[model samples]
Target: MYVAAKGGEKAIANAHRFLAEKRRGNPQLPEMSVEQIREQLGLAVDRVMAEGSLYDRNLAALAVKQAQGDLVEAAFLLRAYRTTLPRFSPSPVVDTGSMRVLRRISAAYKDLPGGQVLGPTYDYSHRLLDFSLMEPEAFAANVVYLVDKMIALPSRIPRLTEIVGSDDLVETPQEEPDQDPPVPDITEEPLEFPASRSARLQALARGDEGFLLGLAYSAQRGFGFQGHPFVGEIRMGYVPVEVELPGEDVKVRIGSILVTECTMLSRAEETGGCPFGFVQGYGLVFGANERKAMAMALVDRALRSRELGEEVRYPAQDEEYVLRHCDNVESSGFVQHLKLPHYVDFQAELVHVRRRDVKKSQGADDQGPSSVGSAGEG
Candidate 1:
């Protein structure tokens, strides 16, 4: 029988109190508001929401502030809070083609339909910091005025994949009656391999950005797939969210969300029982996370090696390995749990080590002090 230890409860409580005090820091300065975090540190909020699998911006911001800027901890907090809420019916599929185009670009062609709309980005900025931004005068005018002269894009922009598919340049999955399978939700059911493409995509969407980025880089550098894939298109904007009323047979647009999407084009193997044509990988993420979206697209393609009849020769191609370790919360918990007390197991290990050392010492003593001295020296 296991007995519960007593008398550490006060210490734990005091430790928590100390943590809260430390998190506040510098009482003279005004406390940061949740709204400020929501508007200013939006990227961090977006990451927390994406990884937590929750879509509430205000709650995500609150989590970030409560966790004191530790994004993973914020995600953990948000995820824990998410479990208490009741889940209603799933939302209908989002249509990216009808997204309000704030930013769109393509690497396949010099210019394409809808043109290259470079929205808020640091891509062209010099790495050196501009001290002017620190001045009070720098906040004089909002940056939105700079783009006021640019013409607005149409309501619906054509996807590059659709164009390529129509021209027979890329292998488009047919939507035949038998081929159209229901998408599995990774959050609802336990993941198993060989996982369906939809399940893998869902897992990837909620995966750690840093882990996915590293894996995607490795794949691009000849670890899984050879040669670089082209960014067919990358678009970021606001997309409308809709949900069908239960038993009403009608859908309603309740809100809109900012999202980033990418499509990567790669050479497909002909042995997959299809004609030689380019294949595409798709990625969509909440918020304007272009790097994560691009990385996801690349890794998504690498994970399709088995379906495309390519050899699974690298880590990126292994679905089970990728999906299982992709969740940062799970990985962090397993790794950090080692800090907890393990007195009994550690004591046993220590006893075994001491006995082995004593046995070695006795053997050395049998061989005289000379051997003992040599053993001690070496």
Candidate 2:
């Protein structure tokens, strides 16, 4: 039975049905709404949105349900669905400076222009499980808040890069090293090494949360955290994406997207023949995942030096190392699906090993009874 070819078609159907049944256990009980999952199980949805690069809480909730609460699988579902949606023109470059922040914190400064706002986060929540929620709630409750909008930002829109650009005090870029960038399509194109910073980030934006976190942790644990990453700022909110139209001269707001952007500081280091300069580590993910984004930023910076002719000495410093490992769909599918039949290759290996053993034994026999004193390692 184990050697027989899999009835893959039937097995797939049966497995799918089993999964659906498990997702909706006890159909007789009142159906759980997507909104309930979105509101109650928000952290899962947040991770999915962060990794999937979409902010539709409803779709994320459904994905979680379909994935049976497996965050990685849920992220994959969201990513698949997001890819299927039509692409509108990008909204005008929504400035992070102008973000309506849901959560904002800065390790750089305790008090900055925008006083840190820890808008919505579970980081402060205790991990203890609650058992009383098995029973239904009597009623929904409302929360209160004080409203203040963009009070920290200057009304006059100043160049953001200009403010930070001068701090380097070294050989500077002729201009913004990253200008109007051409975005790459990850779903359609195979990931290539020495990918542009933009492509690297897009891949990270859609990478697995656990995977990214692990890579980030490895670096911090002495794998490659040579340059201690300082969280310049971790801001979570929506940014407008602008796209030019066929006949329009002015770029218009195509749509808004939630993104977590991280900027890491690297000390000046001379590489190859170039003089030292402040290396900027940047990371951008779909939603509010500051940790993942921050980790991605570190990895991104590490990868950049390779293309810049800097010698790579650390695993995390290698672009291929981080980007190749962060993709869960590719890794998980490839690993788990190995359980499927590949007996042909195994049989060939088995036959080759047996023949080699037989030949070795014959070689021993050729030595005659003297082999009793000349035993050899296989």
Candidate 3:
């Protein structure tokens, strides 16, 4: 049966007002502030910022609150806001080597030059929840000491990749001065096939964390992946951003942003029948999102199957599939759109099903009970 649509304008307005009421919940409880979400629910904000491809923590938190903690929807809101903002000059390449290191770890080497500074991480913590956090105690002075130590730490730490660079064990692609083309901005153009390494990296940087995480895990489980990959290094900290304005020769520091960087080393066949060695895959993302950074790194390495002369037979290894579907906003929009009114489409499908059943019934009646027994006997 087909249903008629009614109460178009007023019904929508009433629905919106009802939604507001539901979102508010009990009026007795104090409403949560955006700042509270930004500071307290920082990890959620970080995920939103990373996937949304925007770096504003406050706005990301606001989106989270508005979306009722639905992270994908929050990311969608932030991305929509990003489109309305005016384009400014691109920032200079960030120097992670000079980062004020907060947390740094190396799975490849235990004793490196930096001596594995475990600044702030949940890796060592027990999984048990501390109910005391429901009413947290006052902050202690050790936290202050930790912050001071982070600030006073030497400006530049030697990069692990740099140490191995001279050895030529990893396939490091170097940029030729005045010879290499500028990296394509994935945001400014549609993603085309046979994408450049830079373009793939750009797309993966903002891809959905859960999607990347799953694909990365699949790669580790022998799906279009070869050998075990080691985390060369993972670092999380604030790196200063600088930009040179138009018609100005000097560059000014535009403040710092918290970022996580991961470098993964996977086995690679050497060129010209040389000995086997490791190739690096790099991942960097906004805010302290180590999981996303690591996942991105794994996916990055998997996507390099073609360049590495490896078999490309899995979804994780397919650049077009990964890049096209990893976008949470686009995926969410398409999937969620099914919730919209499909009255006409449903009616058409219903009519087709009824007609099919009627034809089957008529055919059965024409054969009758005698025909059914004769066919069975035959």
State every prediction's TM-score relative to the real structure.
0.89, 0.81, 0.89
lDDT of prediction 1: 0.85
Per-residue CA lDDT of model 2 for 1-378, tens digit only, reads 012245779887998799789888899998778889888887778788877667788899999888888987787788778878887555554577666566667675566455667877777889887554454452223333445553454332222232444554422335645566667777678888768777788887777767667777776676664556667667777777778885778776756777777777665445444344555677777665777788787777666666556667777777787788778776876677668777898999999999999999999788887566656431
Residue pair clashes in candidate 2: 90-241, 90-242, 91-241, 91-242, 91-254, 92-241, 92-242
Error of 3 at 281 (Å): 1.8
Give me the runs in candidate 2 sitting further than 4 Å from their true place. 1-12, 88-92, 130-165, 169-174, 177-181, 270-278, 307-309, 364-378
CA shift of 60, model 1, Å: 1.1
Ranking by lDDT: 3, 1, 2
Assess candidate 3 and give its TM-score to the true structure: 0.89
Question: For candidate 3, what is the lDDT?
Answer: 0.86
The Cα local distance difference test for each model comes to: 0.85, 0.70, 0.86
- Report the Cα lDDT for candidate 2: 0.70
